[model samples]
Target: MTMDKQFHEILSDTRQDFSGWDFSYITRTGRMGSQLLSWSYGSMAIPLIRKAKSMLDMGTGGGEFLSLLSPFPKEAFATEGYLPNVPIARKRLEPLGVKVVQIEDDFNLPFQNRQFDLILNQHESYSPEEVRRIIADDGIFLTQQAGGLDCREINEMMGVPLNEEFAHWNLETAVMELEANGFEISTRKEEFPIQRFYDTASLIYYLQAIPWQIPDFDPEKYADPLYEIHQIIRENGYFDVSQHRFIIQSRPK
Candidate 1:
């Protein structure tokens, strides 16, 4: 097929509707793939969830991961910042006895002081002070974060500047913030794993799923570059980039 036709075709194919935090569309289909991190966030959280008497999953995207931890504590709860994911999460988790709440400002979480003995946040934004306030003195706050420079190669390839707002966010910064909030870090880890996009459409789909990668990415706006990358993919069979990720587990001092 012609380059123009393939580009338009790829655009149409990847523009399909997406929701929540699910990436199975690309990942499951083998379009996009990522190298394994040194640690497994889910595996690590399982034991913590099983032990806690009461736990809160901050920013539960559609309650997908939370749901996996069945037989939750008597007072299990979850909070989601995105509006669309609220209903989806509630529907999936509420039936299982997990209360799902919609949250907005990270600094002002709507919950009683020291309400939870365990708090989990993966790829979600949170405030150290707010987390400190809501967590019990013995509570564990475990989070896996997408570092400021997560998948920055996409930004460079698309000709967009990196997001400066969170450019300094990393494991060290997070540990410091938690320590300042009177928490003692128990474990901290960081990794930069490779992510491969087997096709140009997979790359486009990824950027769509993660809008913050290139804040104003439009297929048309970056058509030339996208096509160029697509050609590179046709020649190289894959496009690789590094993903920055960090995990921190802490508790109140």
Candidate 2:
């Protein structure tokens, strides 16, 4: 098939409904892969989850990750800010006695003060004061965050403008924010891992799903750059990009 034909076909196939926070298609196609982390976030969270009587999972996208750590606390609750993911999360987690809440904003948590003994957050924006308000005096907060510079290489490859929102959001900034909000930081780690995309299709699909990476991204609008990237991928085996991530564990001061 011609390169143009192949590009169009890949674009068409990738433009599907990306619901439920699942990336099975990206993985199944064997087009995208990432380096493994040195430490397991799930393993670190399991013991903490088992010990807490009340737990809250922030931005529990489709509750997929939270569901795996099941046999939850007696008061298990999950909050999803994305409208599409809220219903999906409810469908998956409600059956497990997990109350899936739809939160309109991350700044304000819709719960009573000191409502939870443990809060788990993954790739979610949060208000530190709000977290401090809702968490028990001795509660724990564990979060795995996507650092601001995550996937910057992709932006450079496509000539897209870099997002400055997370430019200063690193381990130091996170620790300062948490401590400033009355939390004592116990564990902190950050990593910049390599993410490899073997095909242009995976890259397009990822950009489509994550609009924040390229705020004005549209396959049609970015056809030129996308084509250029596809040509580079055709010449090379894969495209490489850096992915920034950080994990922090803290308790009320």
Candidate 3:
């Protein structure tokens, strides 16, 4: 097949449906891979979950990760701001006795004050004050954030705009914010792991799924840059970029 035809075919295949925040397609296809962190978020959260009488998982996308941390607390609840994922999360977690709530905004939590003993957030936007309001006096809040500069090399390569919202959202910044919100920081760490994409197709699929990375991304509109990136991948065997991530654990002051 001609290079143009091959590129189009790959792009077409990569643009498949990506629902419920599941990334099995990318992982199963071996199109993309990332290095592991020193500590696993699940492992870090298990102990906290075990100790708490009530727990809340913020932004539980399809309840995938929350479901994995099984044997939930007596009062297990989850909030999902994304409309489509709310039903999916309910379907997956409700059977397990998890209360899946649909949230209209991140700043406002639909719960009584001091309701949860443990709160977990993974790659979710949050309001520190809301977390403070909902958490019990001795409650713990643990979050793992996706750093703003994650995969910025892709934007540079494609000449797309970078997401600068969390550009300064490091461990220090997170700790400061938590402290400012009346939380005493316990643990914090940050890592920049290398992520590798074996083919341009995987990259295209990722950009599509994560539109914020390149807000106005379109395969047809970016065909020229995509072609150039494809050539680079063919020559180099893969494209590699750094993925910034940070984890913080805190409790009310």
Candidate 4:
């Protein structure tokens, strides 16, 4: 598929209906997803990150990476697509002297060419155009994404089988997209057997609201009972799930 078409599909898949969802419940007891993201980036990009003056952390959720990156960077700015996350991120990062910007209205970054030495995306939604257009010639782009096989079990639980074509998420595809955008591959790191515990109901609650899967699914037909089953898993001492994370580091060609 063309990059534009692929990007459209990605955007569609990640749209979540938060009309009645409870945010406080998740944040209070939710699993810290950043632990996985941090582990992936530390393993993939930290060693290659040399001295840099300015850096951008795309989709800097919770600003954990930005906080960690502050010591090594002279100036660090973060962009987040979701506005609800902005306040918390600002609160968490601003105290640490990091600048957090909201990108909800604009996906095309407002920076000039070669303005930054490093750009990082830890599980951010990125298209080839955004990557190609925004990255500075000498800047580095490091991305860590949830692997293709990661969402299968959850999808099965939801009973809405994700279309295979729409589910084409893997290391080879990620490498190809980066290379196609003129990024020379520097490192590809894979994490196998990533295990996490989730109360089945909580998992479904997130699965329903989060965009890890596709969009426009039938929730009433599937979401409720799935949560009930999740309760079973929770009572059984949580469900042990495995996922793979692919971290690719690329530099401008």
lDDT of each: 0.89, 0.89, 0.88, 0.64
Misplaced by over 4 Å in model 1 are: 1-4
- Number of the candidate with higher TM-score, 2 or 4: 2
Instruction: For residue 232, give model 4's deviation from the true position in Å.
Output: 6.5
> For candidate 1, lDDT tens digit of each residue in 99-157?
99898899898899999999999999999999999999999999999999888888788
- Order candidates by TM-score, high to low: 1, 3, 2, 4
Candidate 3 deviation (Cα RMSD): 1.8
Q: Which residue window of length 10 is worst by lDDT in model 2?
A: 1-10
> Judged by lDDT against the true structure, how good is candidate 2?
0.89
Error of 3 at 37 (Å): 1.0
Tens digit of per-residue lDDT, candidate 4, span 8-117: 34334543445322444544675413224444566455654446667777787767555665464656778877777788788888776668888854447776666777
Lowest summed lDDT across 10 adjacent residues in model 4 is found at 1-10
Considering only N, C-alpha and C atoms within 3 Å, which residue pairs clash in candidate 2?
Answer: none
Per-residue lDDT of 1-253 in model 2, one digit per residue for the tens?
2448888887777765798677778876777998988778899899999999999999999988899998898899999988999899999999998999999877787899999999999999999999999999999999999898999988886787678776888888999999999999989999999998888878888888888999988887777777788888889988888999999999998
**Clash tally, candidates in order:** 0, 0, 0, 2
- TM-scores for every predicted model: 0.96, 0.95, 0.95, 0.71
Q: Rank the candidates by lDDT, best first.
A: 1, 2, 3, 4
1-253, model 3: which lDDT tens digit per residue? 2357788787676665777888778778898999999879999999998898999999998898789888888899999988989899999999998999999887888899999999999999999999999999989999999887888888888896677676777788878888999999888889999999889988888888888888888887888888888988999999898999999989998
Q: Could you say which candidate leads in TM-score?
A: 1
